[model samples]
Target: MYFILFLVCAALTIIGSLFRLNNLKEIKQPQGNFIGQISLDFEEIIVRTSVKEQIKIRDIKNIDINIRSIKGQYDGYSTSKFYYENGLSNGTENFIIMVLNNGIIKKYQFEYIPEISFLLNQKLIEHYYKIGIMDYLNCVDILGLDKREDWEKFKKLRT
Candidate 1:
């Protein structure tokens, strides 16, 4: 009897928690113009990425309004992210905040760029070195095990 009671209580508790978490936005809604429109209460804060339909929230806060900008995307991987935590209020004038891709946020300074370029040159250098070694073994004074050596070296370098 005790086990059955405990199981019921646990199930109720889990359901209650899920309900509260899933309804966080619903719980916080402004009255007046927002009446009957619970879904639109949460405004989308979007950051533009070159890849269409992919966006990171960057940060979220409960406020009277959300001011969003369409900063167009950049090249490379869009990494280095941070959030401006709980800093905006609709009634207040300090809603502006800056976002830097290096995980830094400046107050009200906003800009967007494609993801930064990686060290492609370094990768190309490594590739050239491997090709040079393979060519040397293939065309120059070849060693008895040059082919095997080249294969092993190239495979290891790939990793």
Candidate 2:
């Protein structure tokens, strides 16, 4: 029965090693440059990229923000030519960005890079929201641009 005992120990060791490796994958180090910035004023949300690509979403009442997690070689690349020139390594780094006017009803996608994945997660957790759910609410919380009551009314609309 020594062979059976050895097999059980071997299987456990292999499973433990895999669990450790999975944890390592989740451990992210912010590599490359801080290539993006997001700001909010009373009137609008401003997103600025390291390459000088800027987008301003006007009329806070109508705008919505969405966050997406991008990972792997098969995932798409940034449409902006600036990202290519800046030498952003693809697939190695996985992170989320805020997409203004995201989804089918909206024709255009304006994704804002947050420089680090943790920053985006921290912002969402701090605001008590999840991805794909009331993105505008998260935006409102992160930016601190509007009153809680105003956002609450919007949140209740179920649009």
Candidate 3:
């Protein structure tokens, strides 16, 4: 029937639209001021902002790095405040590094820089190994980190 064919076409169009919207990559634009910096030492991950805070490698619960769009709604108002105060526009991708230590979540947001993001991810992985993968996996759940491949490999090796 024509009605059935029309309904199928309409469903396909809606699905296609949703797929395209989900897959659309956010554009990278110059962002606001850099708020914090992260560096790794022998036993600590030092975060320097207005004040320096050091978190021991053994105390870290989770480390996550992701590209976040400024346009999206954020639970942390500080992120939005910094973005708008620095005169940044919507659709700017921010390189967000979140570290969970002792039940506190510290977020450091910076302008989208691929090299910096890559280095941070590498440093976290390096530090995770120092504490032993088993211990790290115990502290960090499979869903806690964005890098699921590493989690899968470790879980496989453990089994």
Query: How far out, in Å, is residue 153 in model 1?
Result: 64
Candidate 3's C-alpha lDDT? 0.52
Ranked candidates, highest TM-score first: 3, 2, 1
Could you give me the TM-score of model 2 versus the true structure?
A: 0.31
Cα RMSDs, all models: 20.6, 12.4, 11.1
lDDT of 1 by residue, 71-109 (tens): 232211122122211221212121234243455552422
Lowest lDDT 10-residue stretch of candidate 2? 80-89
- The parts of candidate 3 lying over 4 Å away from their true place are 1-28, 68-101, 116-126, 129-159
How many residue pairs collide in each prediction? Answer: 6, 0, 0
In terms of lDDT, the poorest run of 10 residues in model 3 is 80-89
Q: What residue pairs clash in candidate 1, if any at all? A: 74-114, 74-115, 75-114, 75-115, 97-108, 98-108
After superposing candidate 1 on the true structure, give the runs of residues whose Cα lies further than 4 Å from its correct spot: 30-159
lDDT of 1 at 8: 100
- How far in Å is the alpha carbon of 63 misplaced in model 3? 1.6
Q: Report the lDDT tens digits of candidate 2 across residue range 34-142.
A: 6555554333345566444344333222334443423321223332322222123232343224344533232223233446433355443323233233355555654
Clashing pairs in 3: none
- CA lDDT for candidate 2: 0.42
